[model samples]
Target: MTPLHQQICQACMPDSSPVMDDQRASLMSQLPGWQCLLQDNIWQLKKSYRFSNYSQAMAFANQVAELAEQMRHHPALLIEWGRVDVYWWTHCIANLHYNDFIMAAKTDQLNVNSG
Candidate 1:
């Protein structure tokens, strides 16, 4: 099977079901440093990356934005002076989907490629 980072996100609709427990567990295992959290009754894949300065953090955020655009999926990005927090979830379903994991993995790759 292709790695999550190499997979492309599919168009998710409102009716789409969220990732099941077994699948979530399997996918979660593939991503390190990511947390699965529930907020507002929705599951989100989140991670924080540290940088040396604001410029580095902002640059990473921009790279994530470009990735989101390319994938047609966006994440909530919180950029601090030396850190960036990324939250990935499917807005239409208000839950975590396969795309979320894919984005999360790809996001990790962005950090690796950048730093």
Candidate 2:
């Protein structure tokens, strides 16, 4: 199977089901330092990347924004001094989807490529 980072996201329908427990566990294994959690009653994939300065963190966030645009999947981002937090979830479904995992893996690659 293709790695999640190299996989393209698919458009999700409103009725589409969220990621299954078994699949979620498998996907989460592929991502290190990432958390799959429930926040505000929504399941999301989240991670935080650390940088030496605010500029680096902002740059990383920008890179993620560009990637989101390319994939047509957006994430909630919080940029702060020396750190950037990314949250990936399907807004329409308000749950975790395979696309969120794909974006999370790709987001991890962004950090790797940046540093």
TM-score of 1: 0.99
Give Cα distance to truth, residue 56, candidate 1, Å: 0.2
Alpha carbon lDDT of each predicted model: 0.97, 0.95
C-alpha root-mean-square deviation, each candidate: 0.5, 0.6
Off by over 4 Å in 2: none
Model 1 lDDT per residue over 1-115, tens place? 9999999999999999999999999999999999999988999999999999999999999999999999999999999999999999999999999999999999999999998
**TM-score versus the correct structure, for each prediction:** 0.99, 0.98
| lDDT (C-alpha) at residue 37 in model 2 | 94
> Mind giving the per-residue lDDT tens digits that candidate 2 earns over 15-37?
98999899999999999999999
- Model 2 residue 88 distance off true place after TM-score fit, in angstroms: 0.4
